[model samples]
Target: MSRVLKPNANNLETGTTTVGMVARDAVVLATDRRVTAGYYIAHRRGRKIWRIDDHVAATMSGGVADVQKILEALTLQAMDYKIRTGLPVPVKTLANYASVAMFSSRPYIFIAHMILGGVTEQEGPVLYTIDWYGSVTEERRFASTGSGSPTAFGVLEDGYRDGMSLEDAIKLGIRAVRAAMMHDPASGEGVDVITITPKEGFKEIDTSKYL
Candidate 1:
């Protein structure tokens, strides 16, 4: 349920809200399902969250095509790494890889902002934010991106707590995205949520009941 948005000069900043948080034993990612182009709602049910592997997932913001291309490359790279080394790629490693890719493509107008999350045998749950310019930050608690990020950050900074349960984190993630959607014209339609844990790996929650 996603539609492509044609970019324009005035709609260069068009984007949605995406949030990610690390909980006690898992990581949660949530996003609004909207795509916009110069104040026009191009898609009402766009997908912003993606599962990268059994225990890794990502939420994206910025040009849909650019983000999709980066994610596809990351997926292939992850598979190749796993097959060659018989080990899951570290979450930070993936973030760095994405940063390098994005940085390398900056001159070519490639833009993609992403929050990557996953659980590793050694690291437990980890989260990282990679910007379009290749800047990468290891977010210890939570991260939010896109045009609605400011509003989403307000909710996350106020509601987030240390060592919260996965359920609480999911609720907060949803709340953050919902708040952003309410305020940001570029974000709306519905919500999509995903959770990653050692036990369940990566699982998409049924956002239909709530959104």
Candidate 2:
């Protein structure tokens, strides 16, 4: 027999908002800071974004402990790849590993969606939307996940343009998450933002004004 976990209102998948956008020269990722246990606020300053390496990052929307373990494993994989190959691990490879981790859990899935983003010379600015079932889609423009995604998509629609600046991408990412926070009860408190640029690699941006 396998341990099974069913969906509910308070699960990680339905308790947050996370967004990722690919600019011409950068990739931006953002998420809300609230953690909910059903109707109760379990934590106020929850961090959904994890930096896998200097050039890569991911957003989590599931069981915190499970997600953290998956991300930590990815971090080790990245380091090991670089040590072996002498280069940063490609973005798609990281996403694929995440998918495998979720899929391998079988009946007891990881109940999470990860939006992976990074900058690499080989793939440029890359983004991936990965579901709990281990399906992966390479995002050319942008992607959002979690309970607040529907609301966030509304703000992202018609706003993204070709060759937008990194600053513009950051602004748009913040706006999307903020809009979801206003409409989704599970997503609120504050917004966190980060950008991976060709020159800067990975950097966290202050989003106080936008929030």
lDDT of 1 by residue, 34-134 (tens): 88765778888888888899989899788778889889988998899999999998888888889888888746655677899999998899999987677
lDDT of 2 by residue, 114-211 (tens): 89999999999999988777889999999998789999998888688878888888888888998999988989998999999878888988787664
Q: What is the lDDT of residue 3 in candidate 1?
A: 23
What TM-score against the true fold does each predicted structure earn? 0.91, 0.93
Model 2 spans with C-alpha error above 4 angstroms = 1-5, 8-13, 209-211
After TM-score superposition, what is the CA distance of residue 101 in candidate 2 from its true location, in Å? Answer: 1.9
Off by over 4 Å in 1: 1-14, 208-211
Q: Report the Cα lDDT for candidate 2.
A: 0.85
lDDT of 1: 0.85
CA lDDT of 17 in candidate 2?
91
Full-model lDDT for every candidate: 0.85, 0.85
